[model samples]
Target: MYLFKKAKESIVSSLHGDKSSPIIKINYICNCILKITLAICLWLSSLSFLALYLNADIINKSLFQLFSLSSLILSCLSFIILKRKNGTYILAKIKMYPFSFKDLVDVSLLTGVVTISVFDIILCYLYLLVAFAVFVIATCSIYECLDNPYMRDNENISSFSLSFISVLYMGLYVISNGVIFRNLPYNPLEYMGYIIKNIIEDIFSVTKKLTKLII
Candidate 1:
């Protein structure tokens, strides 16, 4: 937020520059902060995700591992494109607000995803998606009686990388009434799947019985 506010102020100030003040040149670096960010923070984030997947039982372990490894490699590759020497710009510091807006946004985005992965928020959100999808599918199938005109259930993956970043960096996972993922650490995959399936089916069975009154 501070970065955005500063950037916004810089833009407005630049448009109404004082002709009275003389212009000065500053050593200009393109995306210097992002270069530092990828070289350090994101590199660590990738390795951290890799370490987790290697030790923990991820749902799609191999793909997750590959994603992490690829990210780590990409962060390494960022150095190849780095500027060899600083360029010059007129009042560059004020013009760029210390760094480009994109640089800070990228940092924030990477940090958010890493936080989610580290805190296991992704796993929690996965089930939330599953439950929402299940409910939507069920309700949509019975839409005529329910009078819901908005009736569509879709998953965006095979067709879309979901901003491409999603499939590549922060992968999306979906389960259709499957085992709770966190349970994999404790129960056998098969047993866990069975438990969740039964629970969902039983809930629906009861719902079906009660819905007879609504119909």
Candidate 2:
């Protein structure tokens, strides 16, 4: 029994060693922080739903929209600060590092968040094609980052990551449902599927276009 316990501990230790990589650490920390921000977003979304229930006046309604947008912007800024290099906005010190594919994916995800935020704000909360495109690619990128075998063997971290993502989606669903009921024309799940469909169509269209050009 003692030998078995020792073996188990050794295995656990080795599994955890993989998560110690700087890239994984940064990604995990960023995900944790984003999850917290998402919780706040969920709370605010609940309040917005309440305000709507109370039949708040136009100015109050406008303020709710403004605050929602503000929160979204802040959450996005948080992601960018942790994941990307920006000269103009200094939440953390600016430093240049060697470019890597993972970094490119992080940048692309951040770009999608920014682009989605702008469109959602300007179009009065309509989910657009670019938003859909960025969302899928970003998620795939993050999953790829988490694909290390040793890290995958770390059951605790794996559970935490799964829980965090589940909560994020739940929060998004609640907010999107609120938006849809309030006649904002955004159903989070439906919008996601729409985005996926568009992505497939766009890929096929691009393939056809390239083939025609070659022909």
Candidate 3:
């Protein structure tokens, strides 16, 4: 009841452009906690479902593919929505869209749920732990960036850059781990080594492409 009241008050304040209201801050904090809790619950439930039916090879393979593909597509869509203007408008045009907010909360929760589900099937627990850690860090970074007064007030150092940085960090972690649709076994230490090699190669590749474009 308290949460409902606060949410209503926050919505009204936002509509009225009452940015100074304490309810706005409370709403933001509550919303973040709710999203994190939902994501964690969804992830744990998905894992449990998978574990309980591990013996069903056909079902297991089908679900693994389904969640993996869904996660990849949703992640890409989420990034595009974050980076583009009129993204919400675009999303609204899509048929049978379920969610209202196509922003951080939706993206984070879906990513968390699907990522853990997919990784649980293919990768070892260590890799799953790394992925979850990255997810948490990235989510927190985005929230901080959005909440930061300096970032919010400044046009130059926009929140989008911080969001992009968080995405880049996650991308690097994923690339280092060599996570793909095809499950492959690898040592965690070797994965770290691969990360360094991949980063250096990516830098050189980008440098060469830039030089070519300039020429």
Candidate 4:
């Protein structure tokens, strides 16, 4: 009983702690919504992909459209909430607070677990895509938090490395998803060559477009 009371107090204190600022609260809420939406998308994508793979006629077009629309709406809502609540104007004034990248990772893991439990299947590829989306959002939030002039001096190499890796992972996951969506032949070793080739081509294409715009 004593331990339980102490634990309850700890929980309350943690929620009401100084780290629980308005911006942090908004970030958490937005992340939660995005995580839920990503889970739905993963489930729907998995179903569709499996149906396509097995030549099953179970693909319900109406249901797929509904899920896709909901996912898009929720994704937009998360973005709007973060922007309106922590717009550049307000973010500029905030000093460095205790931000936990680990918490974001934990949320991502929880999302994957819940998605699998609810869907009763493991769609590794789609799961990676969903996680990539989560990580991209997390990376953006970290960037915004670190954008404050106050944090500029305090930023460390480790945080920057993590952000860079998150972006890299997002890009790879997107490429993998594209490959799978196109129903390309995927032998791990062989498919990697294709993935790398496509990535290089995409980089050159983007660079060309940017150069044209600059000129």
By TM-score, who's the top model here?
2
Better of 1 and 2 by lDDT: 2
TM-score of every candidate relative to the true structure: 0.24, 0.27, 0.22, 0.24
Cα RMSD, each candidate: 23.9, 23.3, 25.3, 24.2
Q: Better model by lDDT, 1 or 4? A: 4
Q: Assess each prediction's global lDDT (C-alpha) against the native.
A: 0.36, 0.40, 0.40, 0.40
Q: Candidate 2: TM-score?
A: 0.27
Single out the weakest 10-residue window by summed lDDT for candidate 3: 95-104
Q: Write the per-residue lDDT of candidate 2 for residues 5-75, one digit (tens) a residue.
A: 44554456566767544434444433454456556655654554555455544223443454445445544
At residue 130, candidate 2 shows an lDDT of 26
* Candidate 3, 64-116: lDDT as tens digits: 33333333433443344433443332322111111211111111222222111
For model 1, how many clashes?
0
Give Cα distance to truth, residue 213, candidate 2, Å. 4.2
Candidate 1 lDDT tens digits, 60-170? 334434444544554443343233221112113222221122211211222322111212222223323432443343233233323422222234221121123332222
Name the TM-score of candidate 3: 0.22
> Which ten contiguous residues of candidate 4 have the minimum total lDDT?
95-104
